[model samples]
Target: QAIYNIRNNPPQEDGACKLCNHQTIQRADETEEAITNRLEIYNQKTAPLIGYYEKEGLLKNFLSLIASDTIAEIKKSLKV
Candidate 1:
């Protein structure tokens, strides 16, 4: 994957920070409570920095999807 390639030859700005795409492939009805719990744990342990990004207007939330769908979602988010 492109991500793996980038990991092996990382960009200069890539310090201790990580880059990733997080996805959950399930409808609301199919989502489990455990998923919420896991997100809570991640929020507690990993999301404070995201709050900082949000404050800076650099944070974005994308719906889960494949490559084509991801492009569509991005376009939608950008109002393009």
Candidate 2:
């Protein structure tokens, strides 16, 4: 999955989302450098965080292949 965010947008005028009919904007940070920087930041921070959880036997890794599945897993883990 790509790492990026679309801010302040909902597509409309025949460009609505297929499922919700809501406008969706394309991510702006699609450049190779931008994406690489993001991944580097994530790798730098996430490893330590995950290490902490793993040491405590509380680590829960979720696959990001399908967004809905990952979100569902997160929600379930949070119990909310």
Candidate 3:
């Protein structure tokens, strides 16, 4: 649904849509395949850092389901 909305509502940038005349951001690479590829690359790159940080005792994980819960956990972790 988010992907559909972003693709449909492309009015945050400078260029206008040729058909609808709505302003368009220049991110034509926000397609599903592109996003999937980016996620795969992110996981591949970050997987090793997780173990490295864990070994150094610098890893703090927050798996909260709610955004507010996660924010609270982050603040607690940072002693904010």
Question: How does each model score on lDDT?
Answer: 0.62, 0.72, 0.74
TM-score of each: 0.31, 0.42, 0.49
- After aligning candidate 3 to the native by TM-score, how far in Å is the CA of 61 from where it should be? 1.0
Q: Pick by TM-score: which candidate is best?
A: 3
If the candidates were sorted by their lDDT against the true structure, best first, what order would they fall in?
Answer: 3, 2, 1
For candidate 1, give the lDDT: 0.62
Question: How well is each residue in 7-78 modelled by candidate 1, as lDDT tens digits?
Answer: 465433533324343321334533457668788889898879888899999887886658888888889888
lDDT of 1 at 54: 97
By summed lDDT, which 10 consecutive residues of candidate 1 come out lowest? 16-25
Give candidate 3 misplaced runs (Cα > 4 Å). Answer: 1-28, 31-37
Superposed Cα RMSD, model 2: 10.2
Full ranking by TM-score: 3, 2, 1
As for TM-score, the candidate ahead, 1 or 3, is 3
- Which digits, one per residue and each the tens of the lDDT, describe model 3 over residues 1-80? 12224466544355566566665553657767888998999899977899999999999988988999999999999999
Clashes of 2: 3
